[model samples]
Target: MTVPRAMKSTMFTLDGRRGVMLACMAPAAAFFFAFWLLPTARLITVPAEKGWSAYFEILTDSRYLESILNTVLLSLVVTIATLVIGAATGIYLARRSFRGRQTLLALLTLPLAFPGVIVGFFVILLGGRQGLVADFTHSLGLSRVTFAYGLTGLFLAYLYFSLPRAVASYTAAAEAIDVQLEEAARMLGASRWHITRDVWIPQLAPTTVACGAIVFATAMGAFGTAFTLASKVEVLPITIYNEFTNYANFATAAALSIALGLITGAVLFAARLLCGLSPAR
Candidate 1:
């Protein structure tokens, strides 16, 4: 039997397309293997050279355990606080227009331009000794209240960066919500609070959760701010730094890094799953 001309053409076209796709994928595959896969394998295995028990010691050792708990707690608190504050502000900004609205948004999101170190410095200037708050309180003959060197200061710095991201995400999500559902609820004699509870909250929940996860992950691995304030704070990132640089404990540092990475990755994976199940999706 002779092959049909159309069949030959179809096969040739498919083969050409497959060749083009493989060619396009070759660089990415090579890069992933060279950079990500290799580094990750090394990170996972290096700690094993000290034995698997070293990984378990992260949970048993008081110092490492404290740092882990501290980082997790701080990230969780920051994520929750940012979502609460950011969702309120974002919904208002998305729903209403007023004079200076643009300016206000610009100011709120201005922190996005700042690096982590800059955020730490900004926190210090707000609450450090000789900071504005300290100076004002002292001028009033009140005892100075400085929190710049502690967990409070680190929390504020994390909040500074995380809030902007939350606001941006929430604002975008709010803007996409259909106004008709809210209006329909109101027409049925629903109060503002009722409408928000019954209509808006459900719609926004997934986006809020996903944004909170991002905030959590960012807070978990944040190094520059922690480094700037390390004298008073002992987050996991700082602990890793100390182990690697100060103590030259490569195995411990690598193990701690892997632990942090795993936690962040797990939260992010959960966020992605939530996003996939979102009503919007």
Candidate 2:
């Protein structure tokens, strides 16, 4: 069965192309296996080692339930706050040019330069028992004010870190919007509120969903800030840290970690779906 020269050459070339494609894909496959697949498998299986009761602990235990509730509430509040403030600031920054505009933007993004722990420290310096807010209240002949180790401090710190990312995302999204849409709406007798509700918001919905998911996820998983600011408050991440480090309960830690990941992922997935984005996106 002797094949013609051209046929043999064609076959050889196709085989070579296939080989090259596999070679090119090798690194990504290996990386995914090593990082995502292995770890995810461990997280899934470790909890079952202690029986299905491990998963129940999250719902059954008071501490874990409280942590879950607090984390969800805080993340929701932060996400809503971030989206409202970020969208307004981002649209304004995108539309108008003024003196020191770049400087103002740089300042707005300055919080991103600090890590969560440092942001927590800053919150404390502003609101702690011995801090400036306390001193000011005392000078005003009021009771010494303290919010540094409570929900208020956590909220501010979360907002501080989450805001810059949201602003940047919303600013870029706002800039990419078509100005002609707004013009068309105006020509059709749309008021400022109408234009915003009809034009800007509809266009920015995807960005809102994206930014909301990010802020929510960050708040849910934030550790350093919660660790620094938590004397009484407890969030899921803090609970996971306790299970892993303090109690030496690897199975429970794995279960909690998986639960956190699932909750965050579910929110992200649902947001993408609601905004008409592909679930995989």
Candidate 3:
């Protein structure tokens, strides 16, 4: 079989392009290996240094178990709240246009600009001992109210942190949905409830799962807000930090880190699979 001369040249050109692309990516690959991959490889093997029983011991510890539970519950709550409220707001914003709509959107997305620690501070200002809630209740001749250092504050801070991402994702998903489906549903005598339940929910389900997984993962691993809120905040990240920093228990810390990562990664993987994506994708 005779190959065309142009085809031969094209194949050579393609090979050259592939080589160029690989060369361009080599620095990044080296940087990732030096900065991330090597450290992660060492960290992943730290449990074996403790004779492989380290993970079992860490899991058996009541404090570690409680921290893991608390982290999971908090993350689940934050993800659910973000999804529900964010979905509604996103759909509304996508479907409606009014004065100051852009302003409202800006305000909605403004939380993304604030880091977890800053959000923790904002929560403190709202609910701290000498903060707005305390002052308000004091003015009303009531007892001082504060929750800034508690689980409640942590939840609020995480929700605030996760909400922006959910809203942005949901808004984009909602906007990308074709309106003609809703019109057809309406023409078929579908009520508002029917249209929403049968049409909108199905359309937005993928975004819900994907965004929920991201929010959950973020909350599961968030440390800055929990740390800033209080040293007493019982979450996995804080536990890991304390083990590594305060106690110098690197093995325990590594085990805890692995556990947290496994849970978060499992959730993300399940979500991707549920949304009909392969692991390669």
Candidate 4:
């Protein structure tokens, strides 16, 4: 009374897959539509009765322009910092067999596990007025310099999170590189610096760029950290959040979200293009 093996295998075939997959996929797709696509559609449809007038108004606003610029600038700065710090740390961790490598890796990625709010809190605690910086400044009879609620604090939080992401991404990429190539370079009288600059860097450039772009986007869209630290910061994300929550201006929020989405899409698209251009074979 056992079922035939061929029939069982056929039942599991890709073309004959059951309702389970379809069922699962349907819910996921609906979730995406409900959470992401539907709102986006509403934003696009509701605002354009006058044919992109709202878009034009948003683009032309000084505040909007400033927010866009601020977001881009902050993201770029954080991206570069993450790339440099993360890549260098990754290379070191990947190459050298150190005693505390595992521990160090965990420590580096510690911030990633903590919520962004906690990172903001930590930065405020360490760098805010009446925090360590302020206490030290007062002790030395110097001006009590403030680090909370500004670009400096926001950047610190960004770097905290971004460095971990960069480290993890670049570490994986670095580990994939063949050790013999580096050994060969060194044996041929290439200095340590020369080996890194010529041999290691070229191989790692594409991965670094791809990871940097991701970190850049994350920084651009970051809300919790930016909100906790710098309400006056005027980044695109903060603006969108304010429009939706504070002002109840869903139209403007939608418009800004659409704009940010396009910019993010373009950045990621360019990164993919760059990734494709690299030698695969």
Over 1-281, each residue of candidate 1 has an lDDT whose tens digit, in order, gives 99999999999999999999999999999999999999999988889998987798887999999999999999999999999999999999999989999899889999999999999898889998879999999999999989988899999999988898888888888999989999999999999899989899998988887898889999999999988765776999999999999999888999999999999999999999888887763
Q: Please report, as a residue range, the 10-residue window in candidate 3 with the lowest summed lDDT.
A: 272-281
Candidate 2 lDDT, tens digit per residue, 26-95? 9999999999999999889999998988889888999888988999999999899988899889989999
lDDT of 3 by residue, 1-281 (tens): 99999999999999999999999999999999999999889988998888878899877888888899899998998888999999999999998989999899889999999988999999999999889999999999999999989789999999999888888888899999889999999999999999999888888988898999999999999989999886556899899999999999999999999899899999999998879852211
Cα RMSD, model 2: 2.8
| Per-model TM-score versus the true fold | 0.93, 0.90, 0.93, 0.89
| Deviating ranges (above 4 Å) for candidate 2 | 1-21, 277-281
Candidate 4 C-alpha lDDT tens digits along 1-281: 99999988887795556676897799899999999888778778866765677688789999988899888898889899889999989988987897989999999988888888888898889888778998999899999978877888999999998899889888888999988888999889999899988778878978877997799889988888988888546888889998899998777777888888888888899999988887762
**lDDT rank order:** 1, 2, 3, 4
Clashes of each: 0, 0, 0, 0
| Candidate 2 total steric clashes | 0
lDDT values, one for every candidate: 0.91, 0.91, 0.90, 0.86
Judged by lDDT against the true structure, how good is candidate 3?
0.90
By summed lDDT, which 10 consecutive residues of candidate 2 come out lowest?
272-281
All candidates: CA RMSD in angstroms? 1.8, 2.8, 2.7, 3.5
